[model samples]
Target: MGYETAKDLTAGTCGGIAQVLVGQPFDIVKVRMQTSPSGTYSGMLDCAGGILKNEGPLAFYKASRSSGTLTPLLGIGLCVSIQFAGLEYSKRVFSSRNVASGTGDGSLTGSQFFASGVIAGLANSVVSGPVEHIRIRLQTQPDKARLYAGPWDAFKKIYRANGIAGIYKGQVATLCREASGYGVYFWTYEKLMEREMTQKGIRRDQVNPAKTALFGAASGYTLWAVIYPIDMIKSRMQTDGFSPATGQKYKSTWDCVRTIWRAEGIKAFTRGLTPTLIRSPFANGATFLGFEMAMRVLNAA
Candidate 1:
C-alpha cells in the first residue's frame, strides 16, 4: 500500500483505541438503556449508578469473562480504524475524480466531504455490524446470567445458531445509521475546522490539534443526533432474542421501528441518548486528537 494509505490506517487505529478507552464506560450504559425494556433504570444516572452498585465498578468495562479482555477495545478500535481509513480513501478518490474532471480544484467541496463520509460509513458498517451485534448482546445480557462466555464464545454460539446472517443481525439498520450519521459527521468536522481556520487566519496544516478535537466532538454530537433513532433500532435488533422454535421479536427493520413506536412511543427512540451525548464529546475528541497526533508523528518519521 502507499505510504499515505498506511499512515491513514495507522492513525485511524490510534484514534479508535483512544475512542474506546475514553468511551467504553458510557457505551455500556448507552447499550443497556437502548436494549432494555422501559423502566429498566430511571435514567442515565440511575442506570450508571445501578451498574456500579449492583454489577460492580468493573461491570462498566464489560470485559470478556473467559479471556479477561475488553471486547470493544479491539472490536471498536478496528471499526474506528476502518472508518477513518475508509474516510481518507474516499476523500482521495473524490479528489482524484475532481482533478480528472478538471473541476475548480482538487480540494473537496462540502458536498464531497459529506459524500466521502457516506462511503466511509458504508465500508465501516461491514465490520461494525457484527462488532456491534456482539457488543450489544454482551452488554444487554443479564447481570449474572452469562449467556455467552466471551466475545469469541458469543460469536461461536451465534454462528452455530444462525450462521453468518445471525452474526450480522442488524446489518441493514447499521448501514442506514452509519451512512447518514457519518455524512453529517465528516461534514460537521470539516465545517467547524474551516470556520476556525477562517477566523484564525491559519492554514489547514497550521490548525491546532485541540481545535481538531473540539470540532470532532461537535461532529460526534451531530452524528448521533441525526442517527440516534436508527441506532435505537439497530441496538434493539441486535439485542433481540432469536429462537429456532419461536422466531425473532423484530422480524425486520420496519418491524423493529413499528414495535418500538407502538410500545414505547416517540420517547423510546431517545432512551439512551443522554449517555450517548455525554459520551460523544470526550470519545470523539479523543479520537481526532489521537488521529491528528498519530498523523503528525508518522509524517515526521
Candidate 2:
C-alpha cells in the first residue's frame, strides 16, 4: 500500500536510472549471447573480451547509442508502474484492511504477496513487450546494419513492416516471462523483507539500505534463474527478421525453444548466465536502494 501512491512514479524513475547505470554493461553482454545467431563469443567473459578486443571497450555502450541508460530508464520505470501500483491494489483486494495496516493478529500471508506479484507481473508484460522489442533490436543487430538507426527509426521500420504487430513481436514470450518471473520476484522480496523486519522487531520504514538490497538481489537472482530461457526466446523473436521466408529463425516460441535446445542442448538455456546473474545483484540492489532513498527524500520534502 505504501508504494501505490503517486510518489512511486518519481522514485521508480530514479530507481530505473540507477538500475541501468549499474547493469547496462552486463545486459549488453547478455543480449549479445541471447541474440547471436552466429554463435559469436563463447561465453560472458569471452563476449566482454571480444568487445574489448575488436570493437573497443566503448562499443559496449554503443547498443543504446551515446548512452546505455536510455532503454532501462524509460522501459523499467514504465513497466514497474503497474508492479508497484498493482501491488497496492492487489493488497487491497486480497488482504483485509487490518492485514494491510499490519494491525491484525497475523502478518500478510505468502499467498497475498504472490497474488499481488502475479497482477504486477502481468501488468509489466503489457508495457515490456514493445519496450524490450526496441531494446533488443537495437542491441542485437551487427554494427553494419543501419536498418534501425535509432529508437525512432526502429519504431518506423517496425511499423512499416508489420504495423502495430511488428512493435510487439514477442508479446507472448514477454507475457509468459514477466508473469511468472516478476510474480516470484515481488513475492520473494516482500516475504524476505517482512521476515527480516519482523525478526529484528523493526517497522517497515526502518529497513536499512543493506537489507533492502539483499532482499532485492535475492529476488532478482531467483526470478531470472527460473525464467531465463523464456527471456532468450523473447530476445530471438524480437530480433528476428521481418520476412518469414528468409528472416524467420523461429516460427513460434516453442519452436525457438526447440531449435535452441537441439542446436546447443541444456547449456543453451544458460547462455550469458554468468553476466546476467552477476549483473542482477548490482542492478536490482541499486534499484531498490535508489527507490527507497528517492521515496524518503521526496516524501519528506
Candidate 3:
C-alpha cells in the first residue's frame, strides 16, 4: 500500500483501540438492552447495575479475553483500520475524478464526503458483521447460562452448526446500518471541522484536538440518530440463535423487522438508544483524538 493508506490504517487502529477502551462498558449495556426480552432491566442504569452486581465488573469486557484479547480488540481494530483506509482512498479517488473532469477543485464536496463514507462503511461491514455478531452473542449470553467459551469457540460452534451463513447472521442489517450511518458520520465530521477551520482561518491540521474530538462526538451522535433503528435490528438479528438445536428466531431481515414492529411497537426501534448515545460522545471523541494524534506522529515521522 501507499504511505497515505498505511498511515490511515495505523491511525485507524489507534482510534479503534481508544473507542473500545472508552466504550465497551456502555456497549455491553447497549447490547443487552437491544437484544434482551422486554422488561429485562428498566433502563440503562439498571442494566449496567445488574451486570455489575450479577456478573462482576469484568463482565463489561465480555469477549476480549476469549483468546488473549483478540476478538474485539483486534477485530474492531482491524475493521476501523479498513474503514479509515477505505474512506481516505475513496475520497482521493473522487477528488481526482472531479479534478480530472474539471468539475471542481481537488477538495471534496459534501456529497463526495458522504459517498466516500458510504463506500467505507460498506467495505467495513464485510468484517464488522461477523465481528459484531460474535460480540453480541458473547455480550447478551446469560452469565450463568454461557454458550461458547470464547470468540474462537463461538466461531467454530456457529460455523459447525450453520456453516458460513451462521457466522454472518446480521450481514444484511450490518450493511444497511453501516451505509446510511457512515454516510452521515463522515459528512457531519467534515462539515463541522471545515466550519471550524474556516472560522479560525487555519489549516485542517491546525485545528485544536479538543475541537476535533467535539466534532467527532457530534458526528457520532448524528450517525446513531440516523441509524439507531437499523442498529437495533442488527443487534437482535446477530444475537438470535442459529443452532439447529435452538433454531432461529426470525426467518429473514424483513421477518425480523416485521416481528419487532408487530410484537413490540415502533418505540422498540429505539431500544438501547440511551446507552448508545451516552457512549458515542466519549467513544468517538477518543476515536478522532487518537486517530488525529497518531496521524500527526506518522506525518512527522
Top of the candidates by TM-score: 3
On TM-score, the stronger of 1 and 2 is 1
Cα lDDT for residue 191, candidate 2: 91
- Write candidate 2's Cα lDDT for 1-301 as tens digits: 4544677667777777788778888988999987775477777888899877867776666555533556566776776655666665676666675566776754567877887888878876777798889888887766665566777788887898789988889888888898788778889998988898889998767898898888889989988977898998888889887667647887788888898889888877777888999999999988878877887787678
Residue range 1-301, candidate 3, lDDT tens digits:
8989999999999999998888888888888898888888899999999888987788787663454345678888988888899898998999899999998888789999999999989999999999999888877676667888888888999998789998999899999999999999989998888889889899877989999899999999999989999999999889876744685778898999999899999979998889998999999999888898899889889
Any idea how many clashes model 1 has? 0
Model 3 alpha-carbon drift over 4 Å, by segment: 64-70, 243-245
lDDT of 1: 0.87
Name the Cα RMSD for model 1: 1.6
Candidate 1's TM-score: 0.95
Question: Candidate 1 — which residues are off by over 4 angstroms?
Answer: 67-69, 198-201, 244-247
How does candidate 2 score on lDDT? 0.79
**Pairs clashing within candidate 1:** none
For residue 213, give model 3's deviation from the true position in Å: 0.2
Model 1 scores worst on lDDT over the 10 consecutive residues at 62-71
Worst 10 residues of 2 by lDDT: 62-71
